[model samples]
Target chain A: MAVSSTALVDEVVADVVDRVRGTLEDVFAAVAQVAERTTAIAAVRAAGRAPTTADLAALRPLLHERLRRRHDLISGIGFIAEPGLLGDVPAWLEWWQNHGEDGLRPLLPDLDPGTSAYSDYTHWDWFALPRATGERAVAGPYVDYLCSDEYSLTLSVPVQHGGRFLGVAAADVYLRHFEAAVLPLLRRLPAPAALVNARGRVAASTDPRHLAGSLLRSVSGRSCGPIPLTLVTALPAPRP
Target chain B: MSKLSNGALHAVFAPVGNLARVDAVVRRLADAIELGLLADGEQLPGESELATRLGVSTVTLREALMALRQQGLVTTRRGRGGGSFVTAPDQPRTARLGHRLADWSTEELRDLADHWAGVAGTAARLAAHRTEPEDLVPLQRSLEEFEAARDPAARGRVYGRLHVELAAAAQSARLTKEEIRIQAEIGALICLALGEDDARAAVVELHRALLRAVRDGDAELARSLAERRVQDAMERLIGLRLTVAG
Candidate 1:
């Protein structure tokens, strides 16, 4: 029974890992398609020129359409241009919200990312991770302090044009929403179980002791590829 | 940590508006004890310390403790190794449980059920939204106790404590206090209704489903389950009332 329980937990973890990776991959593909189809983004790539106000206006509808399509799974979606990539345009940030007052809203006043009020996104994890790793990145199930104190995760896929890195196209998912889809399976296990990130922080756990965001001490489980998350049948016994 | 030691319970210790000091102290302490926030046989602070903490006079605290003693909910010792101690609560008889239900008309019972449904639904929703895995430990433990308890009063206390713990997981003191109040009011009735072993089994299964919903962070489903549980309990009580009347 113990062996089967352990195996069952491993299978569940592997499935969750695959699903998360697949979801992010789909987001990456969607962003790539959006960049190719939108005149604003496409024209910049084709003409090898900086984006203009007209380009932003053209991109807004496309971004909103994409966000509306994924509204059920995500709260917000954005395309962040690399700082100074658009010449006089600074970095264009356009995001669509599905939360309160839902609809498309520019992070800046009047489609301008060059304003003094809008801070630089050069250092942000969503931008920095993809830029640095050149891989699709998953940021957090941590609090989105800048947006709201709600638990959230950001998935970003690097957008590139001819080997030159542009910015990242990203989406924000409220962690609770994601958990609603994932937690049922974990709870079905007979033994205590948890999904822990690479840092050993729990994303969700059936074992009440291994709490979300709490670090797991010496947890043993299966961790599959693409995502560094583990599914453990049992956490290490508590310190004496 | 003992529930009394929770900083959140401090809100109940505050003087209730428009209530006499002794009455308020009695209500607060009784409510706490009934809700399992004051565990059985746990030692309470010295009278002077408790009075200071509650912001009430020592005389009022003494009066309140005396009243609790009279009710068999508290015990006091005079010598060393002494302070006021909570009594191991007895299982209230079916007669006592039914007596509270008898006082309420069907309409009053319905209204109370309606109010309870809203409170329970909100508590479940917020608990699912805000609770961490660790936060649900108390709730899970309470459910296990409910399942294992053979005594009807023990089952009822554990049942009520489950909801109170869910409210605490919501991270809102007001909701937690409100849940405790509702639990105290409805506990006896639920106990009477769930006395049959089959009824108790059904409630446990429903509780398990509700726990799954909360664990999964499905706030809507959690709220629905909680509301349905309350509605079902109220219906059971009303059926019992009608049977007795007929």
Candidate 2:
């Protein structure tokens, strides 16, 4: 029975890892496509000059379509431009998100550097990690009070033009939706299990001791594909 | 509730420790509902599970649930597909706040303020070191909201939110969660003193200065600013309590 349970745990862990990786990869692929299109548009619009905010604004329709296509999984999707790259603004986020039954709407965060309400996106891990490494990244399992007021995971890919770091194309996944999609597999394991980010923060868990957003210490698990997540199965309590 | 909401709910249901068990349980659930940590109409864990989580007897859990029901913070239904569900209470009235403040002794208030100061100061200092200038935006917005608030209750909520955002800027999820729990415990009581115009103005200046210190990356200055702000608020609250007692 113990051997069978161990095999079941391994199978469940692999399934959970695959499900999470598949969902994240879909978002990354969609955002990467958006980035490629953005680069192409920037080249055509700028034509040897710096692209203006209007040029960026023109991509709004594309963002709306992308958001609509993945509405079930993606709560928001858009591009965050490098400061001064658009010529007209110090910072820019041409983002759109689902606003309940009212459908998708543009995210107009405060951008003025002098104001208290400015939403400087430069420091956010989703934007910063990809920009720094020039690679795709997954940021969070944290409450996203700024956009959804829901716990979220933001996947992003750096948008580059001729090796010049332009910005990032990103998508927000509601952690609730992610959980709804992934938790059943976790529940299938006989032992307590969890999916944790590289930072040890639990993204989802069947282990009551390791609740989501809480850090896991001395965790052991297998990495979930290219994403920095691990599937950890806790040993069940021994019988008294 | 989402799984993340489950994490927060766990904090709400954490063991009641050695306090008046039933009362502590009631307060924990009540505060979570009022603070919007528990969503309206959200189902709580089953009684057995909840009892185990709180380290209370089923009987004690029932008594606390009954108290919550009377307070209109929770409702229970019978039969299948039924469980206790949260019903967010209205904002605690100002008179109720005075009564709540009266419950705390001067020494207890001082101790609470000390803890608050320690947490807020650490958060501010770390935010100064870790955040970019742009990351201060949410803190700035919270400050403006506090200044524009027309009533004491609104000011109190915004004040708590500002500190919570400060922890968020520090980029420590644990700190942010701690700030939320602390706010739920003492947030409403602070409204007693924030109602005064002079007190409000003083806080506005302190918040502005704190923001500048964090923006300039002066970690020690930011920590001091944060500590002073909380201590000042505590002093005002203590003065009010004395006047009422006299």
Candidate 3:
């Protein structure tokens, strides 16, 4: 029984790793494509020259094509270049949700300060991690108030050419879907199993007793790159 | 009513009990085949012993076997060392299957997808949490079988078998039972439209990814992929229905 139980965990790990890899690769590719295409333009060359509304307007359709390819998994996609380009305010930020009758439609207010949707996103992990590391990064499984107050993970890739950082391209996926997919498997296990993130917070678990965000004892887990989520299993009682 | 004796009344009504006995026997054997629990070409025990095991009379068991034979799910041979044997499951004909499905509205298809998604998704998630490496042997074997099957019927059986394997890995008997029932109900219709090479290839890719997810213990990914697969099958059938109607 124990041997069979371990095999079940192994299968789940294999699937999660593939999905994470695929999703991250797609996000990175979309970022690279946008960076490659946008950089070719002479007008948007410096830190001060972030793409204008007209520039983003022209580029939306292209990014929409990429978004449609993974419509089943993704909720929204966004790009935020260095904030100084338009003025002192955080400008050059554009995000689109998979809404509207046809395809991806632009999210309103564009992070404007006075709007209720305003956020100091410069410090948020999704934007901050890629900027700090200058490599692909993932953030959240947190409440994304800006994107619908749904629990979501944001995968971001830094757009850089010749050591000059232009911005970051990112996508959002609701965690509910992940839970929808994963919780049942956990629930079926005879022993309790907890899915823990890098910070050691339980993301999901078979033990109905273990709530999300609670810290779980580190036992066994499988990591996917930097995410480092572990599947910790509860040990059995001592046999006399 | 008062004039009738109990024994005489039982004699008058025993056929109802016999009918039920035959039905029970038939369902037990048929469900086992549909769920892939009983392998094709497997031999049954001699009639007397089999009937005893099933706690049914020989006549009733024979009636049930005849029903199975008529449905082309079983074959009987007469000679030395001969007994009842299961026939390989056949793929449902498109026209006949489409007619049977005509009563299923788009809403019903969606509901089936929803039901399948819930069962499979949860089974995968649980399997990820509970499965050990050794438990993956059956799942991997199913994957290999699916890849090697060149014929549509073989591919279809393997495809449906994958879910049952996952449910077993989950170590949940209830989920496994539900998976078996769902497969028996819808596996034929799903396989009917997957005869096209391109469509089958796409499904194969999805299964490969799903297997990888399970192997990696990524419960979230495995669950999502399982749900998506059912949803895709339902959508494909709905589209086929639309085209046939038009």
List-wise, what DockQ does each model earn?
0.01, 0.04, 0.01
What tens digits encode model 1's per-residue C-alpha lDDT throughout B1-246?
233422224434544434477766765666556544466788887888788878887888899899878767789988889889988557564543454356567997899899888888987887776655655655676778788887665676567667766665654445666666666455646777787888878888888898889888888999999998888888888988876642
- C-alpha lDDT of residue A44 in model 1: 54
RMSD in order of candidates: 22.1, 14.0, 24.8
DockQ, computed on Cα atoms, for candidate 2? 0.04
Model 3 docking grade: incorrect
Task: Candidate 1: give the clashing pairs.
Answer: none
Measured on C-alpha atoms, candidate 2 has an lDDT of 0.76
Model 3 B-chain TM: 0.63
What is the per-residue lDDT of model 1 for residues A52-115, given as tens digits with 9 covering 90 to 100?
5466566666667766787656677767777766656655665555655545554432222211
TM-score of chain A of each: 0.78, 0.90, 0.74
Question: What's the CA error at residue A120 for candidate 3, in Å?
Answer: 2.5
Cα RMSD over interface residues, candidate 2: 10.6
lDDT per residue as tens, model 3, A95-191 = 7777645567666532433211122357566777788988777665554543544556677877666676767778876665556656655555546
Clashes of each: 0, 0, 35
lDDT pick, better of 2 and 3: 2
Distance (Å) between predicted and true CA of B166, model 1?
A: 29
Distance from true location, Cα of A141 in model 2, Å? 1.4
Q: What is the DockQ of candidate 1?
A: 0.01
